[model samples]
Target chain A: MDHGQIEATNLIDRYLTNRATPEECARFEEHFLDCPDCLSRLESTRGLIDGLKQQPPDTFQRRTWVGFMGWIAAAAVTTFAIFRPPPATPPPVTIPGPTLTARAGPVFTLATVRGAQADAPIVTVSGEFTLALDFEPAPGIKGFAVQVTSGTGEQLMSEVEHPLSASGTIGIGLRSQDLKPGLYRAVVVGKSVDGRELQRVIFPFRFQVP
Target chain B: MQSSGTGQSFASPRRSRQDLVSAIVSGDRSAEAELVDWFARGLAIILSRIVKDHQTVEDLRQDSFRIAIERLRSGALRDPDALPGFMAMIARNVAIEHLRQRTPGALSATAPDPTGGPSQYHDLARKQNAAIVRKILNELPQPRDRELLYRFYIADEEKETICERFGLSALHFNRVLHRARERFRELFEKRRSGGGIVPPLDAPDR
Candidate 1:
């Protein structure tokens, strides 16, 4: 039940993977309840195993293929539309005013790492941009709670129970005009159905308006 | 015994288990909350492993806490040092009882249904988690190491078999796992403090 025993037996991983005996399970659970370090390790190991379970063989390649096909299909449709013969009685073409395009500003995929180092990722954007926050959702989490704040502690956005996309990434659209160019952090918390906070990830980045 | 890779010691100064038990027996509401807060996550992790149904796991967790508190208040616990083991036992009993009820021809009228499917949110979460795992697997320096993890964790292959196939000694097997887990922990640290972030995908080369 001690930490040594737990490590020697890989008890945390075994317990999570359901490979432990009943006695081992009991001993490890009891030990972890009293040992915060073990408890945290148990949680992290559980997350890792649960995540691995969700992935089938070739999951990444399959998803990448699907994404690639989607882009190809979109491009084909665009090409067909552009090259198609003009309609016999086309309506008068009207010029549109200056407005935002369907696609937002530069899309930046922000990587959430261990901490804020001197070379923290920097995103140079103008007008509005999209921040893609990638995270490993814990098993059984129902929704994610996200909060964005400036380095100075100014709250920018707060959301509870935000629905996650199928890609395991959530895109946050922010206007560069509203944010001053310093440091900003986004905290994404995965919550269970009962609103329990299961896992949390922090993404820190510097915003530069060019 | 060593501190976790996160470098934050969870064994910081806190009320002893004996103090917690005595406070609870003395009708301290804060003590009750503290006890629940301390053990709730661990209990849930334990119970969820036994019970597949999310709702049932939740119900059993609450029931375990209630029963433990009741016993504590009634002077049932003999040794304050045995609090963790005692709570774990209570949770296991609750989960087992629920499982027994779920057995064919054993379910009572009041027994909660066990046939419910995972919610949509659960499915999405699984997909998201799978994506992250894929990223981690790709980051591994060796494909063989990735395969080792996949076989051990996802394939549920036996450790002995995996080690034999990989030609790794028992110590080496443990080392691979320990290293992978440490890397996983390093990337997965919650509320990480100051560190350098990777540049955006499209950022110009420095």
Candidate 2:
């Protein structure tokens, strides 16, 4: 076996024997977490503790029952405690009020959009971004949609999923790596599933890639 | 709950609630022992359902007994004859407390993959935290409330047990457990605040 494997085995040995220092045990657990074979062995070894037989309490204890009951009676009789219930507190009142500036429109003006760093680790590895939207949302435009595209016009975005109903939140985002270092155009569409009719607007925007 | 008190040496699935209670109160060591024995099995089953750390559960099983025995010795048991119920209560308090005391985050919670082994040290640490929390829980109310909840949750003991012990139905048991937990939470919060330690809550609720 390789030295690394041997080291792992020794760590496992320490763990099984319960001789491992806490730190060593933590290290061993971390090692086995990524190594499947060792994890299985650890599980099988730990299974033996399950076989313990269940037994009742002792006869000596039971023999103490009459005396025990006597003690309980004695304890209760002398413990003449009077607990008057405390007056209950009233529940808090919640007051809902109206807000002044509810939907004053698109605060996220395109201040500046940047591209990903060339050495960025694992771009496109995780998360969702809006592909296309016709325009910035107005009053109640439900959700906006954009036809995301590569400079080559190849579609690089998934079909627009409802942000509120399906995903619960609406966020505007873009991809950095998949596109060339120039702006490509796409139209945004706004739609809604709330059954309230929404105006759809599509807007074209520049795409940048680093 | 079947009485194990006959020539056949068999536990009856047909035992009445009173039969179980009577057996226990009669100083039948077997009754108390049965309660403890059954408690471990039932708790192991409930715990295994909620948590996958079998090793930790094993250790927890032993700790449950240790706690129950201590309670029994000190007369913390609400109803000594209702040992099974008492055992279950102790077990639940121990389990919940241990679960709470887990050091912050032991699991590497990055979207659990399909073919994965769980974190081992994390489990042990989590169990250790739980044990600590249970110690704190012991400091809250007497073992009876703890046992009542345990009988309700972990042991999944039938309402019949509750009926036999408390002379109340399942619904009353449910409400009682709920209130007991609330009381525990209240005590915990009080301790967290500047509120000084409340004496062991074993202040006996009739």
Winning candidate number (TM-score): 1
- What lDDT score is found at residue A19 in candidate 2? 37
Query: DockQ for each of the predicted structures, in order?
Result: 0.13, 0.01
Considering just chain B, what TM-score does every model have? 0.76, 0.38
The window of 10 residues in a row where model 1 chain A has the poorest summed lDDT is A95-104
**Local distance difference test, candidate 2:** 0.36
Model 1 scores a TM of 0.55
Query: What residue runs in model 1 are displaced by over 4 Å at the alpha carbon?
Result: A60-210, B2-14, B105-125, B190-206
Write down the lDDT of every candidate, Cα atoms only: 0.59, 0.36
Cα deviation at A89, candidate 2, in Å, is 66
How good is the docking of model 1, as DockQ?
Answer: 0.13
Q: What tier of docking accuracy does candidate 2 attain?
A: incorrect
Provide the TM-score of chain A alone for each candidate, in the order shown.
Answer: 0.46, 0.27
Counting only residues 3 or more apart in sequence or on different chains, how many pairs clash (N, Cα, C under 3 Å) in candidate 2?
Answer: 23
Query: By TM-score, how accurate is candidate 2?
Result: 0.24
Error of 1 at A60 (Å): 8.6
What tens digits encode model 2's per-residue C-alpha lDDT throughout B1-206? 22222212223222333454456545556655654543444445333322334556666778877776555555565543344445555655675566556522211112122223435654343343333334433543443444343333222233465467545665665555435434434444455465543222111000
